[model samples]
Structures are given as structure tokens and as C-alpha cells.
Target: MKNNRGLLIVLSGPSGVGKDTILNSLLEKSQNIKLSVSATTRSPRAGEVDGDDYFFLTEKEFKTLVNDGGMLEYAEYNGNYYGTPKKAVEESRALGQDVILEIEVNGAMQIKEKSEDALFIFIMPPSRQELMRRLVDRKTEDEATINARLEVAEYEMSRAGEYDYVVVNEKLDKAVEDIQSIIDAAKCSAKRAKKFIDEVLNNA
Candidate 1:
């Protein structure tokens, strides 16, 4: 009874977690879902496409969009603005495509405040040590940056209680399976099935 509208899924996790990897696998496995690309005011790096990588915007354009309530959620960092475009999300959902918003905890919380129909999912690392190990193994950042990420991760994990589901990312395959199952169950929820139920009763 999903009807003609798709579910809005908000996925949030701390930095250094394998959220991008997990999401890539999930997208490869499913055709009915699509990632919600974010809009940003930052300049694109090498080989980055304008619309594909991000909807690149000037600062004035970004501010105008935000002022007009065109953004689902937004944040400013390092003098650049990043946000989810509400129109694109609504258009996708209207086409019965499940749109997954991979954002930070604060953005997820903003979605919660604005949209009650969204399902919030948090990705949890196996443990602090394992998370740190993964971050260290990347070797892309200095020790200080890695330590800062760990601290931020702790804060993000503290807010996991607010999410509807928390998938521990110990095993990639298992975590993806769990999320698939969760989405399947959410689709069949009483609220989602109400339309079908009404039609059946009316026919009877």
C-alpha cells in the first residue's frame, strides 16, 4: 500500500564510517531507490560534474533558495553552503522513487522536525576502537584530524537513540541486508497500507 508515493529515508552517520560504501552497495542492489544529491555553494574539484556531483550554486543563489523555503535542510561550513533541495526530493517521491538522504545528524533532525513521514536510520560503527582503527587505516588525515573525527563520532553516536533503526557496520553485507529488511517492513506499515485496507473494506 505504498500507493503512488515513495518513502523518505534519512540516513545519518558519523564521519569515517563506511556510509558511502554501504550506500553504494545498496544502490547497486536496488533500482527502486535513488540517492538525494545535495546542493552546495563550493566550487567543484577536478572532474566533478555540476549536477551529478552537486548542484553547484553561487552564495547569493543558495541564500535565496534557503530564504524561499526551497531547501529541506542546510548548513554552512568553511564558508560554503550545502543543502538538500526540497523540490527535487518531492519530485522523486512523487514518481514513486524512494529517495535516501545521506546527511549528518543535524540535517536528519531537521528533516524529522519538518517531515513526520520520513524514516531515520543511523549507521553505527562496531566499537570505538574499531572505528578508530578504520579511520587510522585510511591514512588520509593527520593524527589531529583523525582525533577530531573520533570526538565528533562519539557525539553523533550519542544521538542514535533518536533514529528509528541503527545498523551496526561490522559486516557490510549483513548491514545492507538489515537495512533492506527494514525498508520492506516500513513499506508494509499500517499507515502505508491504510489505502489498500480502505479499498478492500469499501469493496466488501
Candidate 2:
């Protein structure tokens, strides 16, 4: 139903991982899901729009939100602060739109602690060697940064077991289908669809 509550989906992976790629591709296929854009203190690059890409703010503004408890979860990366805005996410969910967040490992942990009902997903490549190749192929990072990302990926991969679901991006189409199946299964869970069940039983 249109009035049904939404599901909060937390998606996380390493820096060079395909979280964004998979999410964006999923968005193209699914019309009902809303992508959660984070707020950041870092300046946007050329062609990046505010609210569309990220909610760009100053360091002081970001710190203000942090101190005021406006952020759901936040962390500093490379001297820039990034966080999810709690209010926007809640409002979107209340409107029955599935909110999918692309977050870091630490932020995902925070979400798990706060939103226990949230569905957490961990995305991974087929292997570390393949992951490195994908990162190199991006041509967006230097050798030093690439190595550092690989190191972080190893540690992040260790935390994959903590998530509710693990979808390896061995092949994009198959992974997307797997993710869709997970969402469908979650929607049909007894805990979430109790109202429909009650109505059906009453009618019978």
C-alpha cells in the first residue's frame, strides 16, 4: 500500500568498491527506491549539484550538525566530514519510499546500532586481485591512494559477516537480481506485512 512504512537499507563497501555503480544501476531498474545522498564538508567537483550529489557545507556547519545531533552517523575522511542527515531519511521513509544509503563501514555500524530494523548489505568484488584491477581501471586515484584503499578493503571485507546480506558483484546483472530478490523477500517478511496478513485472515 502507499501508506506502508518504508525500509531503510544500508549499503556499504570499500572506497574502490562498486557501491555507487551497483546502486545507480539499481536505481535505473527500480523506480520506487530513493537514494540517500550524504552531507559533506568537502567542496563538490565540477557538475556536481547540491542535494543531488551531496549536501555540501562548511566545516563549521558540519560540526554544528554533529554537536546538535542532526546527523544520523558521521565520520571524517581525508580531513572532510561526511554524514547522513537524519531528518531527510526519516521523512523519505515515512512516505513509503525505500531509502538506500551508500555509506562507509563505520557509518554503517552506527546505522545498525540506531536502526535495528534497517536492512544492511555488504557489497564486495569477486576477489582482492579483481578488486585491485577495477580500482586501477577507474584512473581516478594515484598508486599510493590505490594501495591504501586495498589495505582498507582487506579490513572492510572482514566486517562483511556483520551485515544482513552479502551480494558479491561478480557480475552486475546477477548481483542486481540478487539484491532485488533480497528486497522482495524483506518486504514479504511477516514482521513487516502483519497488517496485510490480518486483513486477509479477517476477510477469510
Over 4 Å off in model 1, which ranges? none
Q: State the displacement of the C-alpha of residue 106, model 1, in Å, after optimal TM-score superposition.
A: 0.5
In model 2, the Cα lDDT at residue 177 comes to 89
> What TM-score does candidate 2 reach?
0.87
Instruction: Predict model 2's lDDT versus the native.
Output: 0.88
Q: In candidate 2, residue 36 scores what lDDT?
A: 89
Show the lowest summed lDDT stretch of 10 residues, model 1: 1-10
Backbone clashes in each candidate structure, one number apiece?
0, 0
Best by lDDT: 1
The superposed Cα distance between candidate 1 and the true structure at residue 154, in angstroms, equals 0.6
Model 1 has a clash total of 0
The pairs that clash in candidate 2 are none
